[model samples]
Target: MKQSNRKVSGTLRVWSGVVAATLLAGCGGAEPVHPDEPFPQTQEQAQENVAAAPIVESMDAIALDRTLTSRTRSLIRARLAQGQAQVHQQVPVVSDSGQQLFLNDQGLNGDVTAGDGLFSAIGDVDFVTHQATQDRIREFQARNPQRPLMASTFDNRVRVSTRPLTALSPSVFQPGVPIPIFPAGITFAVKPANSLIITDASVINDPTRTYDPCSNSGNPNGVWTFNHLMREMANTYVSPSVLTEHWLRQWTVNQNINGWTVPARTAMMPYILTPWPRVGGALDLTRSPFKLVAIVNRLDLGGGRGPAGYASGNAGELRFVFAAVDRTSGTCGVRPFLVIFEYGVPHSSCDAVKTWAQRWLELSAPSMVLGSSAYNAALASLTQQVVVRNAAPRKPNGSAINQIRTNEEWLRYPWELREFHLMGSGPSVNRLQGQPTVLTPGDAHNDTPVLRDFINANTPAILANTYTVPTTFPTASTPFLGAFPWIASDTTSFWRATGISVNEARHKFSLNTCSGCHGRETKTGFTHIDEFGTLSPFLATGMSDPSIAYVVQDPVNTSLNREFFEIEMRASKLDSLANQSCLASAFHRRLTSAH
Candidate 1:
């Protein structure tokens, strides 16, 4: 059987009920006054004038939670889990820039430094510091005896290995390539053979290269080490949550190499192999997990003063902010991407909101290792859920489907028809002061002349719904006047998903032209164009065609249209049915491993 296009059949009724309730509230218990009488200024005054206004206070939560939704919550949970698994427990091997020495406790204790270089000692030295230095020298000698320890002009500097040291060749690390070495010492038996050993008193001419055993193609300076450098990468940001720590631990364990002094050495290897390698690698190594990015405590102003709701008193009433960061490598070059979620709290207390934002940001930020694509993939996956779930479904009326079919026919068998007919009716047509006519579906003529006339006459209606007051139904007039339970439910879901503010999503969808179809014509009327178009007495005055040309003229609207076009194009680019189906599939996959 052909799949039914109807996912929701009762939407019209549901929206109608909502509209009725809104109208009742707006009328404010007053009898219909003459057209000449001034409308009530305050909602309370309106209520006094109308009979039985629906109590709207009960629904105020709708605007409060517009951004939070269940699907979004799930996605966020998945991301948090992945982040925790990928980021916690991994030891940082390199410095913040991935160019200097910084290792785990055990590795640091066993290693020694001399003139900006690290080495292993062959024998005991006078002090703890000196012994540590000597141990590195001995370790280097054990790997290369041909070059005995040579004294440097600088005190405490010794060249223990005969092999010369080479500077890092690349600005970024590339996977699968051998690291170039000027002087060879204990050659690590890793697959790439880039690992090196050092001796006490020996000053590694290029300490940067000594620690980074991965290929140096992407990172020429060998600055992409798994140490603090990975933690500092601008693009390697994450949302903080319980899952964040879990992922970190998972990455640390996977990257831990047996007998390796730098624990990050093992961790970073996996990152180098992945795209957006640091976060991706960490996520991969940790087996993908989920974590929380932020949470909503309360919205200070219920009435327009928040990011999600309409503005009322002060525009700066919203107080909350959400933020995330990634730290991997400087050469990684991607900036620390941040998303700010604002709430209805006063702006004066933004600092407190920032504190919350920082908590999540720090949690999500990658630590001493290159975060892998797995983390980013998890984020993207979660974000996709938000985008998909929040996207307004095609109009329930078969009109959208009919349009598609009509467009298809135009593409296929071009000669089958000589003229095109755009169907539908409403006040949309009235916008055309004068234009040529086109053959509608019922009309018989297929000739070009007939089509030309139809096009000229009906072109105005074609642009009608596209630019109207937005498609989403308006739930309330003045901020906080009415409540939408669905909005609250959606907000809750979003909170559970990403822990960031859902306000942005709510605002985006609320402003969608499609949703306006369900909205009431007047603040005190129960009529919506979608249901009571003919019955609505105000239809003659309330409805106005949105200017399609305005959409093309306004930069913001143009950008929005461009983005939508790109998305449609991307969907069209799929080569096979299977690929296209995957894009629409709702099945959820575990982004992280069971471990």
Candidate 2:
């Protein structure tokens, strides 16, 4: 880490390279090793060998496909069935930097059996390209200042979706999780009147306020126009009065719009909402809003409580994901915010929820006119039957209402508390709560001392089970991360969830947070998806380029990437999940049609 140490390591590495070359040349006219390289000198070759690290090169160390989780196997089968997702990998075993060990089904790439589902790739690790990789080489030289050369393995991370990068789409053939609102006859932009931009105070009240699409609906087919539906969802903020107070007046909603200077619109509109894709219990529960947000799948929770919380995880949910945005209007000031509305499927049934999601998919298709009488009829069923449960955001004293303060997965937080989050642990989701719940000057814009303490304490324990889905064994001090990338110092460990380093795991989790993802930590500006159908460079580029050498640059730190393509991953997982079969719950059971 020190300058002096780096200089000394450099010298040692050069000398070691010379010695290795001589040794190789002596091996019956083998190709001479380049003096500039110690071993594992090329990107493609380095994945197989890391002579610079203390790692032992054991091809068998990683397992076969048979070791895959039931969900993983099913996802793979689904991909294969769809005519795409032909990638075969054993361990997405990536390095601390970002090179992945490319296992293969082809016999040419270290595969013993070419046709079997199991994949194998030999670490021809002959070079290093990343800082993490170079650091390990230097560390090895320091440990063995004057030693013989040996072989090793590589690693990288961010428990990314293992499926091939599928493009985002609604058709069953091209499945993905988040459906970009563009072109859809829905409220795609985040602006007043034009779209649904959530804020604290209201300014331009719609001339036509239809709160419930089903109420006094004269349509023979029972549907409301898409514009009418958007207006209705927006009116709920000011309509029925009581909800207007609890849902929009406080917490981040307040900070979100607090300092706006617009003459009439006091509230600084910040969020753009989009629906996640899936039907018949098929939405991918491994991405944002579901995997990393406030309300999450039990598998995403950590500590012993994940299982406990998940035991009752059966309700169907309709998620409306919100991304914080900055408008060019007025002072142009808006608190960074990321919020989601997980609507309980009508009648709380998964089957009905499937229909709810299916209808949304139909509405999103650009071919159909939202104002058509037919579309309106389809919209009527969900709007009239929907209910905002008592479990919704904000309550008296800016406090929370949930199953239990410690265990409630659905509780929303004030701006100060929900700024950052730690997932997969007890209480499953940990909000970045300050010591004494302060609401005065909102948006710390960084990881508070409280959150730092929590992450610093628990990361090592997370590494202990790196080869498996990370479920930190409830350590008091959890792994901490923020604007800057933080590695747990445990190099050899790999998180089974993504086959990446503990460091990358941190990157992925932090990248999902409202603050971490939007700020400098991810080199993101304004919104990932902005008003007027524009995308931040990070989201636009990252989604398409999986092997791009871009680093994760957020507010504080920078991290390397292995397989962190956001939308691609979410879409891939959604596709796999959508294709996997699920047992129906009494296909003919009497189900409540409406609330």
Candidate 1 lDDT, 187-248, residue by residue in tens: 11111100000111111112432122222222223221122111211111221122123322
lDDT of each: 0.19, 0.25
Every model's Cα RMSD, please? 34.7, 21.8
Error of 2 at 41 (Å): 51
Show where candidate 1 strays beyond 4 Å: 1-326, 330-336, 346-595
For all candidates, the clash counts are 133, 54
> How far in Å is the alpha carbon of 228 misplaced in model 1?
21
Give, for candidate 2, the lowest lDDT window spanning 10 residues: 23-32
Q: What is candidate 1's local distance difference test score?
A: 0.19
